[model samples]
Target chain A: MLDRDEDILKAAESWAEVDKGVALATVIETWGSAPRPAGSNLVVNEDGTFLGSVSGGCVEGAVVTEALDVISSGAPRMLEFGVADETAWTVGLSCGGRIRVFVEKVV
Target chain B: MKLATLSAINTERAARRPVIVVTDIGNGEQRLVRAADIARDPLHIELERHLRMGKSSVIEVEGRELFLNVYAPTAKLVIIGAVHISQALAPLARSLGYDVTVVDPRSAFASPERFPDVRLIAEWPDVALPPLNIDHYTAFVAVTHDPKIDDPALLHALERDCFYIGALGSRNTHGQRAVRLRAEGVSEASIERIHAPIGLEIGAISPSEIAVAIMAEITAQLRLPKASTA
Candidate 1:
């Protein structure tokens, strides 16, 4: 249950309470053979430690890098990844799916 | 996505109360909705629908894309017996993500060896169930057959408004149980909710099959919408 959505949110809250720069990434839309459903959360701290998944490790590394930038910038970002998209070249979803993730700092 | 909002959502979840975090994905504007306040919200019907299904989805409202992230408590299964059927039922329910607990007052019947990794409580229902906070999210089953154990547990389950309350018995036995419960002052409406002769009509003949049947029924109750007059 530690990896469940509830626990992931709990980690976000605890990380933020301790003054750590925390960012939350959530899958807001998906199509084709998407691995995770909408509302799947990925919580990341300033140290790049993350819990949960949005694309089942297919795009988590890229999302974490973007999340770190979001944490520092304090600005939200909307990210889109599809098998046919330009950004898919480096971190392609092997499942051949499309997912839109919203990343925001947990201020 | 404020920290205060995140903390509040966690508090409601820890209390086993359903909560929703509505995020307007267009701008990252967010709002938290508690269970008691769902009715007054503008999107009450859609909110209740997702909450009941324990699902999260994106919906468009007035051209704004909102993600309704429903945070429902983990569903629990309280088995009032550690009988043969429960041995199978506990593991099956756990596989479906239910926090399964087996209760029986008989020490010999409620042993750790029989129910591995399950929350085994070798105490009477009156002693064991209250602390579990059997809420609307819980699915309660009384499979002990002994009136002394099953009856009280069932009464408590009804009182707590458990989404599913089932008792393992034949129709004939259910008839007798009806009389006993009526005598104990349980209203007719409450008694009608119990799925006596528990489980789906799967024509199950074995203990494992019966467990499957019961779990199937529970899944429907948790996920499917009720027949609506509206």
Candidate 2:
């Protein structure tokens, strides 16, 4: 049966197939405030990926890391990034928000 | 790598997902179109209008040589309890086009005898969830207040990354439950994932009303563009 995540991933997959080799990222959890709620997803590919804004770009770098990891390992991971961190200044998100993402290889 | 699975419901194949497009027809415009088929296409166009407005509906599409309607499939709901609220929730969730599953460890409660058409599981979450492979597409609700049962299921859900994790309890129960979960080594952030007192504040006093509130919250959680549950 096609569940919502599967449907989103399917949508992302078709979008990527027309456009190829994209990385798929899913918002598994979120804290405080975020642009997308959990279960929302986006795909990133070699040239450029879908900018679904899982964490409003606040944690896209962390997600890119995990997306690349999935591309290489075929293993999925859950990632978390937020404004309440020493490195928050570098991340440029100061809204006291956090997002957890699960990146998986979308074949 | 999950391959996309599509419902074979479309009348014609498109290079991409087809969007229902409708063109208004004047009173004397194309009366040659069949009475039955005329409404089909126009209604589908109206459906597309609903979809564009952020409402879900079935719509018709019309192009030079093509005519059809697109129906986006609905989401699913997986409930981890066979409690009273769940009994009421199962049909409601199903009515919303959400595939529903009700899980419970107590055989007396989870038995198919009680929930005839519902997917009822008679095992603990550790035994059940692994096989189910709860994913982000799924919503996990723990209605059984028993910590021994609901906790392990929630752990599996957290690990599997279910989209929604709601537990039924009062303010006092949730506080102590948080302490227990913290003691179990669940991270502060992961512990925060739960939506305790599981339903919205609607002065719900009946099991059915509570079910409505929970489904409403789930709908809200699912619709939000970004997911932040703190």
Candidate 3:
């Protein structure tokens, strides 16, 4: 009965158990025309491998980049992206919506 | 956040008990709260509200953002007949993420070939329902068209807190069914909960269309607020 989110967390745990640095990103909030809903999760491994999604490919690359940093520094980071922001065009979230993703290293 | 906490959460989820994972985003501190422990938790009120709706949310508590990930057991659809509608409804419900179980005492109707990949119980309503563990997350549909079978199934569904109880029949047939239920001493409020005719008024003719209407009505009941008829 493990749902998709639980499976993502389990995957993160397994990755960490094998000495692969793992970071978990979760969608805390979304506004306007966001593709994914809140509470969606994405887990990243140290080798740049990942599972699940936060924004349905809208800002996953940016989140994964931040996740690698979180995995290295062991510090959590909250990322915001939207068409209203200047970074949105670069991050590819220009789909006309805002989303807040929290990335943390799984310890 | 400890790995043991995640393991505990998965254990509770496997057991089909509702659980909420409360995580502090600032410090990465996480705790697993079982449904029974919600009453003792500091965020009991918010946890209860989210649990009832079976949704997850992120809330700010005293300037610290905490994500409440609510994990309830998968909803179930207990159909009490193996008719054509059940054939369509089983896969439809499964596609909609419901754990479906088709119950009928007739072994020929509840055959494995008919309900492949679906759970089938060839037992009478009185014998099968109690073990099915029907709860508030369950949607019960009695479409047997036999009073002896459908009546007991409806009674069991009413006694439990099933979110939806639908019975298949025409208006006149339902009227007669109601009189019989009243004679059996079912409460007026409980009787009112039964959705006779079993589906939305979409003028559905085929079995699949009727299944669509039934699923739509059940979704409406599960997601929408009750309207005032007055």
**Count of clashes, each model:** 0, 13, 0
Candidate 1 structure quality by residue, lDDT tens digits, B1-230: 78889999889988889998998888888999999999999999999999988788899999998999888888999999999999999999999889999999998999999998999999999999999998888999999999999999988998987989999999999999999999999999999999989999999999999999999999988877787310
What stretches of model 2 exceed 4 Å from their correct place? A1-107, B1-74, B227-230
Q: Which residue pairs collide, candidate 1?
A: none
TM-score, each model? 0.94, 0.50, 0.75
User: Which runs in model 1 stand beyond 4 Å of their true positions?
Assistant: B228-230
Residue A57 of model 3, lDDT score: 88
TM-score head-to-head 2 vs 3, winner? 3
What part of the reference interface contacts, as a 0 to 1 fraction, does candidate 2 reproduce? Answer: 0.28
**RMSD (Å) per prediction:** 2.0, 22.1, 4.2
Candidate 2 lDDT over B96-185, as tens digits, reads 767788878889999887787998878888887787766655778888888888888888887866668888899899899889888888
In terms of lDDT, the best-performing candidate is 1
What is the alpha-carbon interface RMSD for each candidate? 2.1, 14.8, 2.7
Candidate 2: residue B205 Cα off by (Å): 0.8
